[model samples]
Target: MSPRFLCTLIIVLGFVSCGLPAKRREDKTKCPHVKAIRNFDLHELLGSWFVVQYFASSEEALSYGCMRPVFSMSSDRLEVSMNFTYTFTDDPAAELLYGNITWEIPNPSRPSHWVHAEDTYEGVYNTYVLDSDYKSWALLLHCAEKSKSPRYLSSFIMSRQPILAPNVVTYLREKLPRYDIDLAYMFPMTQTNCSNTNRESGLDRDTVRYVIKQSESNRRHPMKRLHKP
Candidate 1:
């Protein structure tokens, strides 16, 4: 296949995977919500979090070793800056995937629980801190959107350090069933070369264009989770 053909194919896949119908599917089970750590300090949570375990159903897999989410306080909401490295299906060299997601605490009583401040197709996107000590390990639950058939859920076990402790991983895994999340679908995310935030490739423009086009397509067809189960 010609290089141009491969490029065009990848662009098509990106848009198709991202573009989906936007219809709210309700989950029969009441959305899961573990109690947020009481009196959790948002200031303590403001910093870079290394994603240890990721549970998502997206068709695209998250790039390993570069999934870092940096958070900072902006007014009444939390500003999130996420950076990662992902490549086209067969391409080896990695490209950057960066975006900002803003979250706000709707209830002052539950400071650790937040809702998407920006428009999100995932109806009722809620992010809650299930457990965290503010120094070592943090367990997070992202209820992306509850669908009628398959629920779209994402949870993360983050840590201050790049690597998570073995015991913590075990504990987080055991906690999945309560939320009806399958442990088999969960996988550890890479934290390699995390310090090198400037990593980029010649295909940066292509990557950006694909992302932009995908986003626009999603706006038109906004109801489905892009990840495949």
Candidate 2:
């Protein structure tokens, strides 16, 4: 099969098998052209962050709980990797899913902007740090597009703590509408009753690197799913 068709098939299979949320259609309007924050410090942004609120134009509602991502920057500061663990909100067992996402800083001058470096991802995926304070809270925007296709957008409001102050949440939430994010669906993620389950799936630095390495070695075909559960 051709690469494009294989990509489509992989995406469809991912949504079906991973308990991933089925994608909802976006508003017909084009994706908003947004800007990354100026002088975004990669060092300051490194570390664990709890996702306080998540907004994906492609999702009608929230699907994950206890969404946490730990960011690590390479010593050279050219590559950034995210090791995250999350459970589906509807899941009774609350089974955690571990995933890795890596990106490269195409331009060190624009450290806030990154391009997905994983071959598994089939599109032109770009991540932007719209705003952040590096201590208490942060606002992030991610956009992806492929030839002639409508861009896909998703955002995260992250806090160093499980819960962010309401006023601060509101402050960050206000920044997304300009990018055409719907306020009503910006769902709060549940951080209660969550913990690292086993040693193998632990999100520590060593474990994350091992898991990612294993995944990289197993990728033998273009049809492998791009989006992790």
Candidate 3:
């Protein structure tokens, strides 16, 4: 073959190689695998979860407090309650703030919700990504709205025990960005008591059970001890 022809052939091959289709790649190093949450069981999902790490830019400030949030499935809808200690920076005296939430199933065919707070101003859409095994730990996503950008809203590292496993922490860090979350400013909760117990029935665990039981009791006539979740 002629040298000129050979050079031309090589150039063509290089172009073809460069243009070839490759698997779509994304920067998911810090994101969680969001698709894994699609199969969550609603019946087993009702309970309280404490916030562990949260993205700064999201509505975490108002949501952050001694008590985080509790989720329950009512019929086909989701009922949520945000419980937290509200401390005025100026006052230093802390007061409790509780906000209620209700979310309808996103699509009739899907178990997801376009959740909003019961109060209008505090409304935001969220998708529950992770449900605790016994409804213990949960990971919530603040999906982007028509007027907003995508964000990782709330990440709760709840457990039957107060403190979560170090492995759980590692898993959360690894999985969040796979769902397009940015964790640059994600903050951990300061209430160590909720995250430092060894017994499964410690403060964190009991808090979750008590909250659910109380809600149920309020609805039902008398108190009943159901199986621990």
Which candidate has the highest TM-score of all?
2
Per-candidate clash tally = 10, 0, 11
Best by lDDT: 2
| Model 3 agreement with the true structure over 1-229: per-residue lDDT tens digits | 9866776686677633334465666532223334444565665656656665655343324334344556666554544344332221111122234445466665543454445544443224455555446644555664423223233244445554445677876676766665554566555654443332224334455564555455443232100111111
Q: After superposition, how far is residue 88 of candidate 3 from its true place, in Å?
A: 6.3
List ranges where model 1 is wrong by over 4 Å.
Answer: 1-30, 58-65, 77-91, 120-122, 146-150, 193-229
- Per-residue error at 58 for model 2, in Å? 1.6
Task: Output the better candidate (1/3) by TM-score.
Answer: 1
Per-candidate TM-scores read 0.66, 0.72, 0.56
For 1-229, candidate 1 gives per-residue lDDT tens digits of: 9866776686677633234454654454346756767678877877877777777645335434355677777665544333333222222333334555667777776788887766654566677778777788787777765455444577778888889889888987887778767778777876663333223544465675565566543322211252344
Off by over 4 Å in 2: 1-31, 196-229
Model 2 whole-model lDDT (C-alpha atoms): 0.76
Candidate numbers sorted by TM-score from highest down = 2, 1, 3
Worst 10 residues of 1 by lDDT: 218-227
